[model samples]
Target: MDTDLGYWIIPLAIIGGAIRVSTPFLFVSLGEALTERSGRINLGLEGTLVFGAMSGYAVAYLTGSPWLGVLAAALCGALFGLVHGVICSLPRVNDIAIGIAMMILGMGLAFYFGKPFVQPVAPDLPAISFGWWSDIPQVRAALEVNVLFLIGAGLAVLLWWMLRATRVGLTLRVVGDSTDAARAMGLRPALIRTCATAVGGAFAGVGGAYLSLYYPGSWNEGISSGQGLMAVALVIFARWNPLACFGAALLFGGAGALGPVLQSVGVSEGYYLFFAAPYVLTLGVLIATSSPKRAMTGAPGELSITK
Candidate 1:
């Protein structure tokens, strides 16, 4: 490939990789967004992501149905979230500390039960080839978008609308903003937060399914790549907006794809550094958006203390 042509290919490759790699980030960030919107934070989503990957892959391999695997993953993730929610609801309990404990519990359970699935080849999720119109192999391959990506994107829109336009959304916001206010309105804050956490966990689980059954298309202990933790920062960067989560996910995905794009174009001189693109991007975004005097402009009041 010509040197100049390689430069052009880099952008296209990153675009393609962004769409594919952003799915998990989108789902996880959305999950965290919902949780935070309801006045809770689940840092353990990293463990949830890994556990979901194991469960989804194991189920898919055993059942020969990838969709079923996705379902299983969602259910398992919800269970983890439920546990976290219940524990955090207790008086004087610290949500962040509990989240870390859950993370450890989730990882331990996954590693122990996931041993049987390390070598199994699960059924892979299907993709839609939007790039079929292109005759170029690279274009066609790059445009093969996953169905889950479309689903996640649609959910983002729906979530954004729901949070801003519905009664349920209002209730969640009230509860997140002030537990006393929720009580004044005759709402059960604990119940609401628990439900929101579970829903968030479900989304994270689906993201995990996408990882093990779609892109990387395999289940292993290392499947997550810290995407779960990065999601917390991404949610902060997105200001807890579901729609913004999608856009941030794409940006992070593009950063992650940088290394592969360079290698694809015969530029492997600093391949490893490129792999750190997503992490570097996260750090930079955090530093740029953070403020000492106030929270990021749109942060949930409950989490503002972290500022």
Candidate 2:
């Protein structure tokens, strides 16, 4: 509550919180980016995210191995993506509508099956300590980066590189830009999109694992909130770029942590409203930047989000 305490702790808390909060966003947005890059959009990732969280927690609880839980979550996510991709591959199917439906189905299944594990505790993912040099407790806490964020960061760099220089990247771009071109190249658009969605879903599942196995570190019906859904706007805001998605996710994480930072500094005035910061940021970005053409600035030409 001290004025001096406010200056230091607020920034540190916000930084740490941003790192913690953004992991989910990082993973989801990256996943969404991959899907979009393939000329397909899987809105169902929200469901995949939540379900991954639940399944990951359940597996870790049963097996006592967080890594196994993460793997399970990834597989679950891929399966969800696969289902969505297959359905959308059918002639005249709507991706957006299917995504919404998948979201509902995933959430419903999680809620129904997650009841038993709600009260049980699961082992959390590990963190890497970069705060050993910092004697200050707050500094130490702020510097304790989680393993997943680091992995996600590494994945972002790898994805960016692959997209720029790899043959697979060229294929994704070609399919996304024009199915006709993809067919001209003898690539199956439907197959590419389905695989991309599955991979994207796998990323979303990892994000879910982070939510349940770390940070919030628990299983509950509302654990994910709307992080999965937010990734869509995030993907657009980042212009479908993987590296940009990392920065955007951090920005969102900082926004989300703002309310808590204020409360920690003893600002009791309208504290609850601060919790809405992330959602507000999402809406503002979408409203200010999104257009009728593929939802934003750098969308894939074949993307049918607007149509």
Q: After superposition, how far is residue 113 of candidate 2 from its true place, in Å?
A: 1.9
Model 2 residue 149 lDDT? 99
How many angstroms is residue 282 displaced in model 1 relative to the true structure, after the best TM-score fit? 2.9
Query: What are the per-residue Cα lDDT tens digits for candidate 2 across 272-300?
Result: 78888777777787678755655455678
Error of 2 at 190 (Å): 0.2
Report the poorest 10 consecutive residues by lDDT, candidate 2.
1-10
Per-residue lDDT of model 1, residues 253-294, tens digit only: 888878987887788898889898887887887888777987
- Name the regions of candidate 1 deviating beyond 4 angstroms: 1-5, 291-293, 304-307
Give lDDT per model, in order.
0.87, 0.90
